[model samples]
Target chain A: MAPRNKYSVILPTYNERKNLPIIVWLLNDSFTKNGFEYEIIIVDDASPDNTAEIARQLQTAFPNRIILKQRSGKLGLGTAYVHGLQFATGNFVIIMDADFSHHPKFIPDMIRVQSTKDYDIVTGTRYSGKHGGVYGWDLKRKLVSKGANIFADTVLRPGVSDLTGSFRLYKKDVLEKVITKVQSKGYVFQMELMVLAKAMGYSVAEVPISFVDRVYGESKLGSSEIAEYATGVLSLWMRV
Target chain B: MTRAQQTVSIGLLFASTQLYLALFLQLIPLPSIISEEIIPVLPLWALVSFGSYLLAKLGYGVLTFNDVPEAHAELMKEIDLAREDLRTKGVEVD
Candidate 1:
C-alpha cells in the first residue's frame, strides 16, 4: 500500500485572533471530510492580541492536532515559516494565510492535483482558470497586482502564473531545500520562493483559487513593498 | 546562464545581426522595401507590438478578474457554523 501521507499546515500569524478559530475550524472540517491525516502548526509571532491564548484553547478542542509555536517578538515572515517547519511532522507541508484569504476548502483540490502528477509544489493561483479570482479588491489594487505579476513574468519568465501567492503545498523535502535558498524577508519572500523553486527545477502545478481579501484584518501592500518587489524581481532575474 | 544574461546576449546578437544585414543591404543594392522601410524600424515595430500586447493582456486581466461574492457569503456562513460547532465542543471562540 502507498504510505500514509500527513499534511502539516503552517499558519504564521501576527494578530489573527478573530480569524484564527474559524480558519482552524474550516481546516479541520476540510481535512476530516476528506479523511486526510493532518496537523496544524500555528507559529504565532507574539501577536499582541493574545492570539496564542486562542491557539491554546484550540489545542484543548482538537488536542494533539494543533501545534502552537510562540516566538518572542515579531520576527519576519520567512523566519516564521522556518520556525514552523521545525515542528512539522507531516511529509507534505502547506503554507497559507490565517486571515481566511486562503480558504481551506481548496486544500483537497491542491492535494488531488499533486497526486495526479506528483508535482513538487502545488500553488493556489488567483490569475489562472475561469474560476480563479479575488473578492473585495478595488480597481487600483487589481491593477497593481496584475501589473506586478506581468512585470515579474516578463523579467523572470518563471513559467508560473502567480508568483506572489503564498498558499502553496510542497513536498516536505522540496520545501526545506527551497526555503534554505530563499533570502528575501518581506513580501518578496513569496515571489523569491517560487522563482528559486523553478530555478532548482522543481515541478510546480497551479490550482485556481478564490482569494477573498482578509475578512477581519487590513491587507497591507504599500509603496515600499511594491518597490521591494520590483527590485527583488530584477535581482532574481540576474541571479537565477 | 541567468535569465538576464541570456536576454542581454540574445538581444546583442540580434542587434548586431540586424546591423550587419542593414550594411549588407546598402552595399548590395537590395530591394528598397526589404532594406530601408522594414529593416530600419524592425526593432522599433517589435518593441511597440510587444508593449501593446502586454498592455492589452493586463487590461483584459483587470476587466475579467473574478469577484466571487458567493465565496465571501459562503465563508460568513461557515464562520457562523464553525463558531457554533466550536462553542458546543467546549472551545470558547470569540
Candidate 2:
C-alpha cells in the first residue's frame, strides 16, 4: 500500500523574529491552499531576538501545523535540520530559508514536481531556464554567488542546476541517507547534499525559483564563510 | 554584468595588478638578494596556484561528470512533466 504523502518543513532560524511570522503565515497558506498535509518544524537555535517567541505565538494560531523546537544556542544549519527532522511526522521533508529569501509560493512547484514521479529529491534552482533568477542583489554579491556556483560546478560537477540553493524537498528516507554522508555545516551543507545525492544515485529534480535577497537582518555571507566554502569544496573533492 | 563575467574579469585584474607590482619593483632595482629571491618565487607561486586551480577543476570534472546520466535523465523528465502540469493549473513555477 502506498503511504499518504505528508510534508514536514524544517525551518532553521536565528535572529529571525520579524521574518518568522510572515514565513510561517506563507507556509501555512501555501500548504493549506494546495491541500498538502504538512507540519512546520521551526528549530530556533536560542535566538537572542524574539524569534522563538514569535514562533510560539504562531504555534497558538496554527496549533498542530506549527511545531517549535528550541535549542540552547546558535547551532549550525546542518545540525538544526537534523534536530528538526527528529520531530517531523511527514514522509517528505523540506529544508528552506526562513529569511523570506525562499518564498513559500515555490513549495507548490516543488510538490508538483515530486508528484509526477517518485523523485528522491526536488531542488529549487535559481540558475535554470527562463524561470530562475536572483533578485534584490548588488553586482558584487551576485558575482560572488555566481562564481561560487561555477567553481563548485566545475569541480564537484553535482549536475543539478543549483547546488547551493536551500529550497528543496526530499523523501524522508533519502534525506536521512544523504544527510549522514555530508560532513559540512552552514553554507557548504547545501552543496554537499546535492553532490552526495548524485553520488548515491538518487534522482534529483529541479524547479526554477526566484531567489530574493533578505529584506531583514544582516547577510550572513561574510569573508569567513567564503573561505570556508572554498575549503569545504576542496575537501569534498579530495574525499568524495 | 553577469556573475560569471565579473568573476573572470576580477581574476584577471588581480593577476595584472600583481604582475605590474612585480615589474615596477624590478625596475626600481631593490637590493639584489630581496629582488632576485622574490622574483623567482613569484612566478613559481603563480604557476603553482594556477596549476592547483586547474587540477581541482579537471579533477572534479573528471570525477563527477556523467556519473549518473541515467538517473539525471529520469529526474529531468519528471521535473519537466511536473512543471507543465503546474503551468496548466496556473501556478507560476518561476
The lDDT leader among the candidates is 1
Clashes of 1: 0
TM-score of chain B of each: 0.69, 0.37
Residue-level lDDT of model 1, residues A125-153, one tens digit each, is 99877768999999999999999999999
lDDT of 2 by residue, B1-88 (tens): 3479779999999998787686657865678886777765776799899879866754553333222233334334544554464445
Query: Just chain B of model 2: what TM-score?
Result: 0.37
Q: What i-RMS does every model get?
A: 1.4, 13.7
Q: Point out where model 2 deviates above 4 Å.
A: B1-94
For each of the candidates, the C-alpha root-mean-square deviation to the true structure, in angstroms, is 2.5, 13.5
* lDDT, model 2, position A126: 75
In terms of DockQ, the best-performing candidate is 1
TM-score of each: 0.93, 0.71
* lDDT, residue A156, model 2: 84
TM-score of candidate 2 versus the correct structure, residues matched by position = 0.71
Candidate 2, residues A1-240, lDDT tens digits: the string is 876789999999888876666667668778888888999999999999768877776766677898899999987899998889889999999999987777777899999999899799999987764556665566566667767887888788788868889899999989988888888887888888888888888999999877766656667778998999999999989976
- DockQ (Cα-based) for each candidate: 0.70, 0.03
lDDT of 1: 0.91
